[model samples]
Target: MESLNKNQLALLTCVIALSFSETAQASATALSPSSPGTPYSQLSNKVMAISNERIDKQLNQEINKVNDVMATRVLAKIGDFSSY
Candidate 1:
């Protein structure tokens, strides 16, 4: 799971970087250089923010799964002592 998360982070970073690069190149060639607050930059920022939120959700889900597994195994080992 850790490895999977690392791979996902790497892939996401690469994809976003590539997309930003492509957008920058396209803008440079097709129009004036983009300023800091331009629509293109704003769009890129929004994409990054959204991706970050998604990553956080994925990590939280993974954590919950691990917690559930641990709880189940602990209960199995402890057995039912309530009857005593």
Candidate 2:
């Protein structure tokens, strides 16, 4: 079960990284060379902000799953082992 959880988390990380890269590339290209203070090759701050938000969200989700498993084990220990 722990290995499965690790695999799932790894897969999720890969997917998120892939998608964020694509989005950042697209946004970078969308900005024009002559567009005011913006550089053409520069990535948008919004893209970075969103990517950070996604990473934090994923981390929090994984952390919650781990916490849940710990809580279940703690409960089992506190209660009856015969039931487990």
Please, what are the lDDT tens digits per residue for candidate 1 over residues 14-58? 656655665565545444555544677666675566556655666
Clashing pairs in 2: none
Q: TM-scores, in order shown?
A: 0.47, 0.51
Report the lDDT tens digits of candidate 2 across residue range 1-84.
Answer: 788688777867776876677667756655646566865345467666666776677667767776888799889887887677
Local lDDT at 14 for model 2: 75
Best by lDDT: 2
lDDT of 1: 0.63
Provide the lowest-lDDT 10-residue window in model 2: 38-47
